[model samples]
Target: MLEINGLVKHYGDFTLNCTMKVEPGRITGLVGENGAGKSTTFKAVLGLITYDAGDVTLLGKAPSELTEEEKQKIGVTLAESGFSGYLKVKDVVPVLAALYPAFDREKFLGLCRKFGIPMDKYIREFSTGMKAKLKVLAAVTHRAEFLLMDEPTTGLDVMAREGILDLFREYMEEDENRSILISSHISSDLEGLCDDIYMIHNGEIVFHEETDVLLNEYGLIKADEEQYRNLDKEYILRVRRESFGYSCLTDQKQYYLENYPDVVVEKGSLDEVITMIIGGEKL
Candidate 1:
């Protein structure tokens, strides 16, 4: 349960205008390439950065209006910030317990062991993947009802990413009303985990859709010059050049499937959709 409406932020040259929503009991993904305002949006939502304009409501109150206790209810795993490097993994336990009243210290320690995060080692000495797991573990084990995670699975191997995703699933299973808004460049991570997804580019929200609809209804059409000319462009959302001729993106996969039997149509994965939406020419 987070909602952002025309939330505007500006740096020297870059400006981010983002709008998104996370529903109760859902895992919503904010997906985009690097420097695409994913981190900026998160910062604004968490009140770590001041936005130029627009509204941000987190857990039913303005981000800035949220009290310390209210903030404790929202788990955050930010890419740009974390615990002091001098502290050992074990050293943060008491710190977290003091910060979060509902923190499950035993469960946190258990997760560290499960994820191979050495409790005795200095956090600065941990590998990137290890640090990532530690961040995710901190966010999830606190029993926070809402999670705002930016690149939570970064530096993790495929199996590790899956394990972390499974942890999120387990977190939600424990509370039916819990919600998560996560951002990741890994399309498969969002595709497999998110119920709904928002695609961001150049500081703006480009697309938001249900994962099921995106996977099942949206499609890519590979067509030669002749096939392209004959095909209906009504549903074509974007197009790009290809060695063969032209590749088209459409939200109506079944429409083309039934109408153009000769053309090559394939389901649009999240990666393909992003490639077309951000790189291809809009129709």
Candidate 2:
């Protein structure tokens, strides 16, 4: 439902070049470190920032060409910047209803209550998890067709994170055309929730793959210098030398398991894969 081609943004020394697509009915993830351009890409797609180069297609039209009605079809929740913290939950409902014609006040209030947000107090009194929940509630309460969430689960406890993810799953199941693009520092959450993942580092798209392939086929092998030299390096994508041995990442897990039966090979986690891609040496 969204496409970005050769998208480039520059700010003096820092440059961002990203290209990826988010298909309908799937949650796509963008995982990166701080200052890695995840937010920049999101802003460009939402038309909040102008890019130096390339095209961004949101829904069916260019982001800049989207009409107000079309804009309502998309929802966004940033890590920061939202309704005034001084506003009470009761006070914000009217504002939201006024902003979007499809705003479901009943559903919004129900979610707030269900999630244990107090309506009588101002938003400023809520905790970090409460504030995060409020943002997602606002985004989906309008029944948006697409969602762009940046760090939706940051600073949340395990239970809170699970609840928010469940809400996302429910939202997606409610409509066959819905899609979400979520960026988060928490790699495990993305590993579990995303259908596809795009890894970004130093403002570049380093890797993009289906989550199933990544979890099932990707592996990390620990080998010493002698063993590493003897194994087929063709399957090794990146390698980092540790105190004990070499930590290697590979996409050909089954091949390595069959060929190098003595070496220690284990399934790769999202964090391990990202670490190798960003910091380890290439093949």
Candidate 3:
């Protein structure tokens, strides 16, 4: 439902170049470190920040071309931007209801109650986790077909995060036309929820792959200098040097396991793949 092509943004010395797609009825994840270009890319897609070049199409229109009515149909959660500190949880309901024609007040309040958010208290007084939860609740309850969430689970504990993830899954189940694009540092959360994941670093897109291919086929080979040297470098995607040994990432896990029976080959996670790609050298 979303398409970005050769998107480029520049800020003094920093630059962001990204390309990807978000299909209907799937959760696509953008994972990166704190200073990575994840946030910048999202801003560009939403037209919150003007980019120097490229095209961003959301729901069949350029972000800047989306009318007020069109804009209301797309949900958004910005990390530190949302309701003012002066507003209480109850006060937000009316504001959102006025803004989004299809907003479901009952569903919004139900989500707040389910997440244990106080209705009468000022949002400023709420903890970080409560604020984060409020933003997510506001976005999903608007009846938006598309969702762009930046760090939706931040400041939440394990239980709260799980609850939020389950809510997202339920939202997707409601309609095959729905889709979500989420960026978070919590790789484990994405592993369970995302259909595909994209990795960005230093203002550029580095890798994009299906979640299952990453989890099931990708692997890591931990070997000493000598063993690392002996293996065929063609299969290595990235290699990081460590004090005791070298850690190599490879998509050919079965190939390595069968050919180099002596080396230690283990399944790799998203975090491991990112670490090796950003920190290691490519073949």
Q: Can you write out model 3's per-residue Cα lDDT over 1-283, one digit (the tens) per residue?
A: 8999999998989899899999999899999998788889888889889988899999999999999999998999987677999999888888998999999999998888899999999988999999999999998998899999998998999999999899899889989889999999999999999999999999888999999999988999999989987999888999888886899999989899999999999997999999998999977
Q: Which candidate should be chosen as best, given lDDT against the real structure? A: 1
lDDT of 2: 0.92
Alpha-carbon TM-score of each model against the true structure: 0.98, 0.97, 0.97
Q: How close is candidate 1 to the true structure, as a TM-score?
A: 0.98
Task: Give candidate 1 misplaced runs (Cα > 4 Å).
Answer: none
What is the per-residue lDDT of model 2 for residues 141-254, given as tens digits with 9 covering 90 to 100?
898999999989877899989989988999999998899999998998999999999999999999998999999999999998888889899989999999878999999999
Candidate 1 at residue 106, lDDT? 91
Poorly placed runs, candidate 3 (over 4 Å)? none
lDDT of 1 by residue, 1-283 (tens): 8989999999989999998899999999999999999999998998888988999999999898999999999999988678889999889999999999999999999989888999899998888899899999999877899999999999999999999999999999999999999999999999999999999999999999999999999999999999999889999999999999999999999999999999999999999999999889987
Q: Global lDDT for candidate 3?
A: 0.92
lDDT of each: 0.93, 0.92, 0.92
